[model samples]
Target: MKAIFSWLNKPYYFNPKPLYKLKISIYHGLFIFLFLYIFRPFYLHEFDEIILPYTIGIGITAFVATFLILYLPALIFKDYFSEDNWTIGRNLLLMFVGVTFIGVALWYFGEIYKEPYNLRKINLLQFLSYTFLVSLIPLTFFVFLNEKNIRLRREKKVKEIRELKKVQELNNTEKLTKEVSITSENGKEKISFCIDNLVYVTSQGNYASFFIKKDDKINEKILRVTLAKIIAKLEKYPTIIRCHKSYIVNTNYITDISGNARGYLLKSKVIEIDIPVSRSFSKQSLLRLIS
Candidate 1:
């Protein structure tokens, strides 16, 4: 029980794209439709004369209702369902609620068709309870599989980073005596620092802020330059890589490489925030650069 609870509390994958949401809704909708039409549950088979027509309409109804029940809350409460904080427990709760809503929709359809009340209203709470129960087991199984896959992927990435560690260490060692310079696009501003001491650079409207470590203290320097121009010059130094759209981090300064529901994140002691690894960036390249 404790192990299950811990696993459910851990992060689960989440994608914000409308296409991704649409796919999920479609999948659940199809499942409900197929299940209703094929099994004909709740005395659906007893209405021999009217059964065929009822099944056809109800199946379509289930499809549409399931789509709305599963898709709407995520669409409307997007912030509450962000990838960073989404967990398997929350997913389970959402599915449970969605299943309840599906039951309500199916019942209302039954009433509209004037289907026999062989069972009480709420079907004695059977459809919601039984449908959710049946689906829960399989859903939990798949969630476990997905969790394992994610952990394995994270572990593989860690190994890749470890394999590339020596190269980054060597580069950082050499940088202790070497200096790197960043010149603004307009040629009006420039900043230089011992390569090892430079921590990270972040893009601000038209300026770049450089974070540097000197004598155990952190310092910041700002120059009028776009991150694109800075990265062009910094590209020669493989250790300094752009982990996020607005942030470029020195591999030597990255103390942690972790992942949440969305994707990889880079963390540094000097920097207070976790830097996201956008889908636009090749994770393989980042792994190769970081020790």
Candidate 2:
């Protein structure tokens, strides 16, 4: 049973449109009408007594009416049949019940219509058997089409996520290899390091302190350069993000984050100091840190 209805497990059939339901009903009705007209099944005795046109008319009318009426339940209870929650066995049982109900109703209609004398002779069991057989073909097609649509959508989303991960990895690799050089205002002092090792930078008036990791130890170097100038030079590296007016942190080294009434504090495993994250940049800072 699982192998038989594996296709119906797709999410695409969960919330079908009213128009799509109508189309399915119409298509099923047409198939039923055509099959009965060609085969002239022994259970439907009216085809023997009545002319071809009247037989065709009655068959078309019965199928169209039955489909339209039965479709209401499918539409109303769609959530119960959704892929996230539905089971194949339960779905088949429900469909069987619906088809049986439709057959019984049609059989009653045949009993009431006295003009078609032969239709009144159809037994309840025979009518139900024919209805179930006709319903199976169309329902199978519906499930197959829905499953195909869902599989395509899932594949597309997975491909997009893979491409996005690849792009992020490339950017991270470039940032790790790229070296940045900071020079003093007088051009007499210079500091150079790879963007990946730089943990954070702090501004104190005319001096900018660089915090970096060397041989698994945190080290600091003071430069006679403005924080604004250093920030401008490091703009190309997205991991080296600004967290506060006076502090900029490398998101790569962020070990933990905490928030308080004052603001957020970012801690790095490489460094002993806790870096302040200002209120204005707190939300974005945390997002970058995690990403």
Highest-scoring model, TM-score: 1
Each candidate structure's TM-score, on Cα atoms with residue i matched to residue i, is 0.71, 0.44
Q: Mind giving the per-residue lDDT tens digits that candidate 2 earns over 65-101?
A: 6565546666687666543344444555656676666
Candidate 2 regions exceeding 4 Å error are: 1-12, 43-71, 74-90, 114-120, 137-291
Q: What is the model-wide C-alpha lDDT for candidate 1?
A: 0.72
Candidate 2 weakest lDDT stretch, 10 residues = 7-16
Model 1: per-residue lDDT, tens digit, 41-102?
75556666666666666666666766676567778998778766788888878767766777
Per-candidate Cα lDDT values, in order, are: 0.72, 0.65
The deviation in Å at residue 195 for candidate 1 is 6.3
RMSD of each: 4.8, 17.7
Instruction: Name every residue pair that clashes in candidate 2.
Output: none
